[model samples]
Target: MRALCWTGVNETSVETVDDPKILNDPDVIVKVRLTTTCGSDLHLLGGYIPTMRAGDVLGHEFMGEVVEVGSAVQKHQVGDRVVVCSFIACGQCWYCSQELYSLCDNGNPNPALTETMWGSAIGGCFAYSHALGGFAGSHAEYIRVPYADHGAFPIPDGVSDLSALFASDAAPTGWTGADLAGITPGDTVAVWGAGGVGQMAARAAMLLGAEQVIVIDRLPERLEQAHQHIGAETLDYTKDSVVAELKERTGGRGPDVCIEAVGMEAHGTGPQYLYDQIKQQLRLQSDRPTALREAIYACRKGGSLFALGVFGGLVDKFPFGAIMNKGMTVRGAQQHGHRYIPRILQHLADGELSTEHLATHVMPLEEGPRAYQMFKDKKDGCVRAVFQPNGASSTSY
Candidate 1:
């Protein structure tokens, strides 16, 4: 089979690779259908993540048809069209019982596992890295899904991959971030970044009953899209001061809830610096604070600061006194995908959320590199891109 493999920092190539087989009793093998690139994949490409190696397949979010299953996989079977959970987990783990499958004792089924490090042998999507569990990604003809009973959810009837795909990661991650902020009816919520996750977080805040949702980003196209389609108010961080605008919009007190969806790959980088960092340990950041340092100061004293963005390693200075004086709650967790995918899918089935708008770009899997360039260059009005390997790919795209 041909798979998109990370050859080195700032490089990837489509290479022929071995087919995956069921290794765990609860595992299933799925023929790749609709696999998309994620912002997280950019980290591996840019070398922000140290564990990603040459030849590591790098995709996580996907929906496909089950081609085979192990005897222990009782909940599903071959030909079951399903949305593969981004996080590999055993539903029976202590963490899973608590609905924290991202922290499941059996984490990703990555190959670089040490007995102590891999916990109880659960894992996340392929190509993410050992830190996320080194499962080879689905940017190929097929993928191996471990903890199938725990992670994969059947795409409910009447659902399209165009919409169902977000259930794998972006929408749920947004929902988790908004929920962590403890949004309440009529509360003011400010979200940083206007990407799929950010837009979804804004939408999630709205769905959770926030009176107003303010999204901050530099891209006019994305900001406009967020405003026009998702019913969000917008602030361009580059053109305006996010803190002042956000505070003024919220009537002097900043949003009651603030979510940072932009991860460590801080925006505003040229190719040289971007490439230099690709092979080395690069700096991580909190774009929320970068956009609204005043958010900490301007928050409603007891407001919530939700950092849903992934941080690669350490961070620079943050306003400790601001946090101390405000007495706000701060929380973040990986998308507990298994816990939310089902409910999120149900919402999609009901037409409450439409990922079709979020998918601004779509192409064949062979254009994976170009998709990355378009997304990195911030071209093609790209918010997110999906690659379809099989002829059975979604019709809308």
Candidate 2:
């Protein structure tokens, strides 16, 4: 099998690998139809997240056809079109029973690293890192899906493959933020970063009956996509004062809900950003929380803030004062897709959600290296680069 492998820091390549076989009774094999790069993958690519060894297969968000099923996999069979959640959950654990699937106790087989770092381990995610179970990812012709009954959701006939692909991660991640952030009807919501997850979060806020939703980013292309495709107001942070503009737009009260979707590598305009970069590069901090700090300060008093972004470890200059002084509710989580994927798929099937636009570049698996470069550099207005491993042509889409 040919798959994308993380060769080294800031490097990736297409390499031949052994095919996956069913290892658990609830496992299934999926012949990947479409897989896309995610912003979180950048963390691994840059070596910010430790324990990622050379040749670790890359990718997580994907949709495909079931090629084989294990003895205990009752919900799916061969030929079933399915979208698997990036996070692995056993579904019968205490966390899974409580609907907190990402915190499932049985997910990450290699838990020593995270347990040592964060005091306890979270769930496993496909190809995230060795700290997250070291499962091969979906960026290949086929992938092994464990806990198939809990993790795989069938794509509805009305939903296109391109549309269903995001249900595997991005959309459900957005839904997780909005649903868990305590978004209320008629509330004003602001989301930082106009990427796929940010745009999806804005859309989820709108669907949740937020009176107004705003997406902020430096990229005009993504802002335009948020405005035109997601029907949310867009803010260009580079051109305007984000905090002041947000306050002015919300009648001086600020946004009732603020979501930060830009993770550890957030870019900013001032000395603070440079300082964070220096600290991160020197190993003084594992993450840069520029957008997160801004989100906290910009959030209204008594409002809710959700960190939807992926932060690996310690960050300097966190705004603990603002969070404490403003009486804001703060929360963060990896996507519990099992709880939200069903509704997201229904939304996609009914044409209520649009994700095809996020796939700005679609290409063959051979272009994996170039695709990652383009995606990481944000070149050519490339929002996401989708890879097809089954001899699918780039022009076919």
Task: Name the candidate that leads on TM-score.
Answer: 2
- Point out the worst 10-residue segment of candidate 2 by lDDT: 388-397
- Candidate 1's C-alpha runs over 4 A off are 109-125, 268-289, 292-295, 392-397
In terms of TM-score, how similar is model 2 to the real structure?
0.98
What Cα-based lDDT does every candidate model obtain? 0.78, 0.94
**Model 2 regions more than 4 Å off:** 393-397
TM-score of each: 0.91, 0.98
Error of 1 at 95 (Å): 0.8
